[model samples]
Target: MDINAYSARLHRDLYAAGQLGGEDALVLAEKMANALDPSIRLVLLDAMVEAAGEITEGLAPGAVEVRLAGREVQFAVTPPAVAEPIQPGTAAPAVQPPAATGSEESEADGGTARLSLRLPERLKGRVEEAAGAAGLSVNAWLVRSIAQVLEAPTVQPPPAAPSTPSPTVKIVTGQHITGWVR
Candidate 1:
């Protein structure tokens, strides 16, 4: 298929899916114009339009059906059952992925700093006890502690003052030092 033709179709689909406005369509067109390959651009546009349709339609059900290329794409904006709407004078619950807490690095050998700290025996024992009470392993407890420390920045030490000269200095005569006394 001709990439230009496909790109135009994708743009139309996005508009019909109620996922993009005229300005957004123009922005997408600009991006497609700058793309390296027309086919890749068309594919990306299609994916984006489809994903946007899913998300927006899910959020605002029965809003409208978008018309594109003599066809209409119908979408509903129904939210998840557990997603409760915020009432007046109330804060909306934050929408974050529940499973995105720790180290979601792509590669196995991801560059993460590992610090080995040797605290006093008493402190170590306390940490162990706390970890046991919280039903977490030692490693987990250490990770939590490190995270807390990172969240609260360290108090930097005050800068040192320049050293001053001593009032007097005594010179002891020795075999190795006897050569030069200016």
Candidate 2:
């Protein structure tokens, strides 16, 4: 995308708005616009990066990344991999997969986002206890657990006929022998 165009448009708008203040404002506006050009472009790039993050989340296990060249913005998308579904009552592997080098590098350089989650009272207590046991904050523990799941193997059941029962997958959420059904 042509980021320069957007930067130019914003400069034009700001300069036009400054016209209300007369000749002195016009001169200052031109100077200010030139000074703010880089900042405006930075803001635009940040917004585009944020949009890419949202898209990536929606496509979990897939990714959409935005990169900035000298005067343009580029987007790279990695499509999700197709995998056979796991049968109901079966669990995904407990072993943690090797590090996702790409994700690790990006995550290390990125900032964190807020997530407001509402869990059942029982579940919340269990999560808190587990986090305590692991010597990490609840948020940290949750983040680690979610990361493990995403990095683990994917499991999706085949589609079922309308007249038949939908296939459900069972997952173990914690230490206990629990059946998290879907």
Candidate 3:
């Protein structure tokens, strides 16, 4: 990843905030931004390294490594090796009916339901990376994501307020005029 992009976004936000202080403050902010770029870049790199370490811990045999190569940041991730690697053309295991249980079956059923999911190698890598970043196990991340997608919106949007006429600008007799249109 290009660390410069993060630094640039930080610089833009800083300069925009400086606008609130007027021209003189903006000038000083610009100068400060230039000086802060290097330091901010290092901080961003450090954060990515820390996040990678956290992800690696949850992955066990799978690992995530953050490497800085000159101006760019690179991630090297190794997914956990499957005991039985599926072939390219082979179909994954089909879903099976839930097992029969005793009187306590309803309670167990309400707790956890398992599904066998098959993901391509590249996509699997990305999913692992995302899960690691969020500091969640792959199962938890998938469950949360699926729930979010399936759940209906709980909060309805507020009704829109009546629109008010916006201000307009006009040039009258070589003088600028600004006022509401109506």
Candidate 4:
């Protein structure tokens, strides 16, 4: 039941079968065992060992040997079976859609998108205080504020004259005139 020892043996077997090289097999085996669930680890390991046997069988006699779980295993390689050609009028297999999972169901019901924001500490504290006072979550308060602003009508100020005096305007008879008078 020593996982490290088992992993080492598997690595050696895989390397000997030419399926993997030294060091690579060790790293691969260690990673696979660690990443997979304990319940399925042994099953995956068994499949790997089986594949190694098949791979060793294809090699020249005495080229490679596979050992698994402290026992030597034999293998024989056979020619690949020929696949039948598809007919012109044949219909291809239909693909099925993936099943909906819990996360997908929750997303559909809530219609909510998660957001991660990086805000200044002061701003974040202010938002938290406002949300608490309003009896709403920070997310809800922010969404409501944004929606209100977006839905409100925008106002624009009337245009003003240019700040600089126009060069065309000049004094005529001691009074200002927009244009030259003769």
Best by TM-score: 2
Question: Which residue runs of candidate 3 sit more than 4 Å off their true CA positions?
Answer: 85-182
Please list all clashing residue pairs in model 3, or write none if there are none.
none
Native-vs-model 4 lDDT?
A: 0.51
Which stretches in model 1 have alpha-carbon errors above 4 Å? 1-110, 153-182
Model 4, span 118-182: residue lDDT tens:
98999999997985565444544565566556658987768896666545646567555565333
Tens-place lDDT digits, model 1, residues 47-159: 65557544433343212222234222333232322556789999877786422112322123363344568989999899979856644445445655666677687889799
Q: For each candidate, what TM-score against the reference? A: 0.25, 0.47, 0.46, 0.32
Ranking by lDDT: 2, 3, 4, 1
lDDT score, candidate 2, position 34: 96
**Ten residues in sequence with the least summed lDDT for candidate 4:** 57-66
**Residue 100 C-alpha lDDT in model 2:** 41
lDDT of 2 by residue, 66-106 (tens): 87777889987755554568788999646555324333534
Ranking under TM-score, best-scoring first? 2, 3, 4, 1
Give all candidates' CA lDDT scores.
0.50, 0.71, 0.71, 0.51
Model 3 worst lDDT window (10 residues):
97-106
TM-score of 1: 0.25
By TM-score, the better pick of 3 and 4 is 3
Candidate 2 has a TM-score of 0.47
